[model samples]
Target chain A: MKRVPLSPLRAILARQLRLLRAERGWSQERLAAEAGLNRTYLSAVERSEQNISIDNLYRIAQALDVSAARLLTDL
Target chain B: MKRVPLSPLRAILARQLRLLRAERGWSQERLAAEAGLNRTYLSAVERSEQNISIDNLYRIAQALDVSAARLLTDL
Candidate 1:
């Protein structure tokens, strides 16, 4: 089988993170701090330049007070 | 805040892959073929030994005839 990429999932997650953070009126730095992630990494995620791990997704979801599943919805 | 991991997302995606494949009565090999991925990687994903990429998830979801968001829900 041919290789398939996984960046779209990252894009979806990034968009969800951005939306969720904005909904809470928090800056990326604040969200990163809250999610216990590096601000630079968070910025890269928001820009779809990075693929986030499951653990980080959970942390961001938790920091946003939503289920991890919510971040993957409607994308 | 402390560093948070991203394995939970991988776990959730793995579970979703297994559930979706079961619902379709397909083996990991079949799903992997349909998703254009390595059967070994598919097995690893089913066993939670690997983290799937967003592109691969979309392929799997398409192969299973579901939205990518569906894979992330209810976990």
Candidate 2:
């Protein structure tokens, strides 16, 4: 794996995503299905290895039953 | 110019960006320079024609001296 620099914002997003998913006891596959996203892509996002667009962010937030802004909280 | 469908979240972002820039009396070029992004790319984003990643969003938020979550509000 090519080691890539992690973005601070992405790191925040990763932590928030993981926390949210764990709270609901949903596996990444489960969340991916709910969000209509590929499991691999969702996994990558949780790892902070993907530079996801706002569209994906919105979808994930929606699937997690929250506002997109909620996921972006704490910047 | 091909018309791409606008995303609801992107529309919110565009409106917020424009409002923020206007509040500061900064032109798009000025904000782009402050954000270390291309002027044309910022312009496209303002028009809701860009699929901007979180990295770009972070940069813009930092340039505007606001939290990324602030820009994402009302979504």
Error of 2 at B60 (Å): 0.2
lDDT of 1 by residue, B1-75 (tens): 675554666767777888888888999888988888789988987777776656666787878888777777654
Q: Over 4 Å off in model 2, which ranges?
A: A1-6, B1-6
Q: What's the residue-level lDDT of A36 in candidate 1?
A: 85
- After superposition of all CA atoms, the RMSD between model 2 and the true structure is 5.2
Residues A1-75 of candidate 2: C-alpha lDDT, one tens digit per residue:
112234478888888999899999999989998887889999988888999998888888878988777787753
- Residue pairs that clash (backbone atoms under 3 angstroms), model 2: none
Best by TM-score: 2
How would you encode candidate 2's per-residue C-alpha lDDT over B1-75 as one tens digit per residue? 222234578888999999999999999989998888889999999998898999889889988999888888753
